[model samples]
Target: MNTHPLRWDALVFGVLFALVLVGWALLTYDLASVDGLAVAGLVTLIVAGLAGIALTLRRTS
Candidate 1:
């Protein structure tokens, strides 16, 4: 039988994604405006994407 090695990148990505969701929820609840939600969601997604990209680059390098 063959098995694959454990990966930390997947774990990190999941954690970061979850954090983005939590942050967006909190921001939506606190701000309660379409504009606010849009801004918050955009920022949260950008930060998460950057983290994921950095992790991928690190692994490749």
Candidate 2:
């Protein structure tokens, strides 16, 4: 059985994943450029995105 808190956590994780994906895709698609602070932002997004996913999946296991 899952609680509301867990469900919310999962949702947040999903959103973060999507955000990171979009950021990367934007760079790849040439729709945006990531330089300087933008580079840092992407790195943060990638790490945070992976961590969020790991936490969400861990909760399921």
Candidate 3:
């Protein structure tokens, strides 16, 4: 039998992409205010930073 390692990078990219799409949809529908958008942007940045750190740690290990 053969096994393959999980693709964490692709998973992270997909999650981030989904987050952006959701934000875009909220803005399009006027469901989110300016402040909400700002918060979402900040959250996205934080998540990206964390993902970068995680990937780095994974590579080092």
- Clashes found in each candidate (C-alpha, N, C closer than 3 A): 0, 0, 0
Per-residue lDDT of candidate 3, residues 1-61 (tens digit): 8898999899878987888888889989999987988987898799879988998999999
Error of 2 at 13 (Å): 0.5
- Candidate 3 clashing pairs, residues 3+ apart or interchain: none
The digit string of per-residue lDDT tens for model 1 on 1-61 reads 9998979899878877886677677766784565766786799779978997999999999
**Compared with the true structure, what per-residue lDDT tens digits does model 2 show for residues 25-55?**
8888888877743876778879978997999
lDDT of each: 0.78, 0.79, 0.87
Per-model TM-score versus the true fold: 0.51, 0.47, 0.61
Return the TM-score for candidate 2, rounded to 2 decimals.
0.47
Candidate 2, backbone clash total: 0
Better of 1 and 2 by lDDT: 2
Residue 34 Cα positional deviation in candidate 1, in Å, after optimal superposition:
1.0
lDDT against true structure, model 1: 0.78
Worst 10 residues of 2 by lDDT: 33-42
RMSD in Å for all candidates: 5.2, 7.5, 3.3
Model 2, residue 56: what's the lDDT? Answer: 95
lDDT of residue 37 for candidate 2: 37
